[model samples]
Target: MKRCGVGSKNQAKLQAVASVFAEVDYDVQGFDVDSTVSAQPFSDEETKAGAISRAKAVLEKDVEIGIGLEGGVMQMNDGLYLCNWGAIADKQNHVFTAAGAKILLPEEIANGLHRGEELKTVMDLYTNRHGVSHEEGAVGIFTNGVISRADMFIHTVRLLYGQRCFYLS
Candidate 1:
């Protein structure tokens, strides 16, 4: 357990990381870093690179461990899916990353994404509210509260932590 620095003070990311380290007696601090937050053409590879880049920035801020959480929408042959990526960077220069569960977006939302709109913006417009990304998010909107943004990333954080706890041990 070490001091953890999160790239964004986003509620979901905070809860996701804190939930994992709750029993470990480690300090978790949240920050609002300036991140691209999305890929240029919208691909998982760029999404992952963004997460790693943000995590490295946080690590440079004197944190023992840095975490990054990025959410994006991916297009498939059949449809679009909401996707999330998470990365962990340690002082040792080791990095581990993972992604949350994805849910296909409704055609309406998919159309917006295809038009170059971000998922959060599209979700906000669809739900007729603001800041949904910081709250329940697309996953929540699709899953009907069965899963939350926080809950979704918690699983991803676990995946990242699993590697950290294993190889870094």
Candidate 2:
């Protein structure tokens, strides 16, 4: 079986990626690795750089396929938001990337987050609800359940892998 190494031990992220490639007959494996960039990556270029860094770290293990998932938030004029990015690097040095959907935040919440407050804290302060992290809400308290971040990551990976497969064959 072809083996693919994922850059995180987060079960949810791993499962999402695995489900997408499962249809293609690849054996997906998850590993614990730091996916952080030296600097915060709020833009596409920086985010891609972070993903590449993680992929390179995984490649050091000599895996046939290396996968990295990165989550970043940027502040727009309106508010803060979530940006999830993924990268796939093959042993031959071919790299493919996909970005998950963006989730915008409210202005007040964005300011609070920029001050280093946790999402859960912000949610509780704004909604008086507990455990209301991004994992609970699609974007923020105002927009909950409108989308699934996990689904976004899965879909992105599937699309990227599809494109990469064509080149590999």
- Most accurate candidate by TM-score: 1
Every candidate's lDDT: 0.84, 0.70
- Per-model TM values vs. the true structure: 0.93, 0.79
What is candidate 1's CA lDDT for residue 60?
A: 74
Instruction: Give the per-residue Cα lDDT of candidate 1 at 93.
Output: 90
Off by over 4 Å in 2: 38-40, 117-143
Error of 2 at 167 (Å): 2.6
Cα shift from native, residue 42, model 1 (Å): 1.5
Report each candidate's C-alpha RMSD, comma-separated, in the order given. Answer: 1.7, 3.2
Estimate the TM-score for candidate 1.
Answer: 0.93
Supply candidate 1's per-residue lDDT for 36.
Answer: 65
State the RMSD for candidate 1: 1.7
TM-score of 2: 0.79
Per-residue alpha-carbon lDDT of candidate 2 for residues 6-87, written as tens digits (9 for 90 to 100):
8876655677778987777778878777766633455666666777667666877646888887666776676677777788
